[model samples]
Target: MANPMKIRAAVKDGVTEVKVLMSHEMETGQRKDSSGNLVPAHFITELTVVWNGKTVLDAQFGPAVSKNPYLAFKFKGGAKGDKVVVTWKDNKGDSRTDEAAIA
Candidate 1:
């Protein structure tokens, strides 16, 4: 599992726009290290966003995603003071969950 992550989110109107910067070393198997050996691919595979316990979005990722991925999206039906939760899981079983108060 990943160390505790930091989440930043906000709400505008009836929408919640969230941006998450997860700390990770998303290693792609196609990359080579200083020793010229192929590094095993280890990247986030799943991501989901929820508002007030209702799922708003879900996605699956691959090695192509950038390191320490930053995701931004908007969800409808969000209200002020609602709780927005973001969670992710990596291929190595590392996971994280974070929440921020809307508005």
Candidate 2:
């Protein structure tokens, strides 16, 4: 299993902002190892964020994204103490989900 994601969410002035940091190797398959062997592609393909049980953001990522990706976005209609969930799935069928309480 991968490491747990770091999530931060806060609501201010009726807007909720969320930030996430994911841990992954994100190999592009084109990179060569020290042994001169190509690395297999390993990257997140799908990501979803939900605020209080409602979908807020959905994204698709590719190998081009850097490792340990950081994502931040803002949405409307969230309050303090609301639940924010983030989930991501990689090309290798690996997935992770984390949640944060809006402050």
Q: How many clashing residue pairs, candidate 2?
A: 0
lDDT of 2 by residue, 1-103 (tens): 7899999998889989999999999999999999999989999999999987799999999999999999999999898888999999999999999999999
Residue pairs clashing, model 1: none
Give candidate 2 regions above 4 Å deviation: none
Residues 1-103 of candidate 1 have per-residue lDDT tens digits of 6765566667777667887787788888999989999999899999998887789989999988888888888877777777888888888887888888777
Q: How close is candidate 2 to the true structure, as a TM-score?
A: 0.97
Candidate that would win on lDDT = 2
Looking at candidate 2, the ten consecutive residues that score lowest on lDDT are 76-85
- Name the candidate that leads on TM-score: 2
Clashes of each: 0, 0
